[model samples]
Target: MQRTFKSKIGILTHILLLITIILLFYSMWIKSIVFLVIMLIINVLFVPSFIHTEYIFNNNMLYIKSGYLPVIKIKLDTISEIISHPKKNSLFTTNPTKRYALSSDQIILYCKDNRRIAISPYDKEGFIRETIKCNPDIKISE
Candidate 1:
């Protein structure tokens, strides 16, 4: 069975992003209509990921998707541990690991090969449970 968990995005975050985009387009329009239109088109194309980011657990794989960003696939067997971070902080950090998170409340999946990826799912507990089902030996840390 395949399970999908939506990303946890706050209302304040959405409002801020929307306002920023609108302000940017408005400034662009004041300078050049063509540039404004092009930016608008690009933003429209990339907006879906912001509104509907999700994580999918299908069989032995975990898929992380955000906007027009490339999908990240992690095999269940390769995940060695899961660490949950339920705090408020900057979403885009200078951390070396790949992050598919919109909010600070996220889980870091530590893989056997030493690769780490962070993701934020709405149902943190359920996501962990589903992952454990696929790879029973995976460890969990708070």
Candidate 2:
């Protein structure tokens, strides 16, 4: 069984996208080559990425995808624990984690090798349920 989950786009990202587009049009109207180039780069590289981020679960593997970036693949069985609503920038937490989430609230997947990956799916509960269905032995932290 294969399932696809879209990442939750945060308000900040939407605001940034709006600003970028406004500036892009403004730059074009004024014929400013420098601003146009900068806006184009941001629009091409950053905006699409946040808007199109998604996670795919298929055949015991989870694939994380964003615009233009390479896909991240993880084995479902390798996940050891899942942390919901992790505290951000806590001084006590020194553990390094890779984040693919666009929102502030995220789910963290801890793998067998101590690798941590953060993600934010639109349906957090459903994502957890599906993940548990795939890997029953995985631990969950509220």
Candidate 3:
């Protein structure tokens, strides 16, 4: 069974996208070649990514994909603990993982390898419930 979870772009990302679009059109109006090129790059890199983020939970594997690239993949069985809401900056602090989300109620995943990953899904409860259903041994932290 495959359960797909969608991510809502955070405020910061939304603002950046809006700014990039505004500049993209402004560059066209001004006919600035250099500015147009830079805006195009920003639009290509950030627009497609933040606009389309889908987390796919397939069988025992969880796939974090954004647009064309796969971000993170984790085996459901390897999840040691799951935190629905963690303290700000306290998550992934000193950990090797990267910031997966902005200022939102993110779900933190603590793996058996002592690494934690943060993620924000539109349906937090449903995501957690589906994950737990896939791996009954996985523990959830409040």
Tell me, by lDDT, which candidate is best: 2
Scored by TM-score, the top model is 2
Q: Give per-residue CA lDDT, model 1, range 1-142, as digits (tens).
A: 8889999876755876787598667868699877677767766765676786899988789888888778889899999988876334533442544877666677888899877777878899999999988999999987
**Arranged by lDDT, best first:** 2, 3, 1
Candidate 3: residue 47 Cα off by (Å): 0.9
Q: Report the poorest 10 consecutive residues by lDDT, candidate 3.
A: 94-103
RMSD of each: 3.1, 2.3, 2.1
Q: How much is the lDDT of residue 107 in candidate 3?
A: 81
How do the residues 63-118 of candidate 2 rate in per-residue lDDT, one tens digit apiece? 99988888989999999999887776631252433678887668888899877888
Candidate 1 pairs with clashing backbones: 49-67
Clashing pairs in 2: none
Instruction: Indicate the worst ten consecutive residues by lDDT in candidate 1.
Output: 86-95
**lDDT of predicted model 3:** 0.80
Q: Measured by TM-score, how close is model 2 to the native structure?
A: 0.90
Give per-model TM-scores: 0.79, 0.90, 0.87
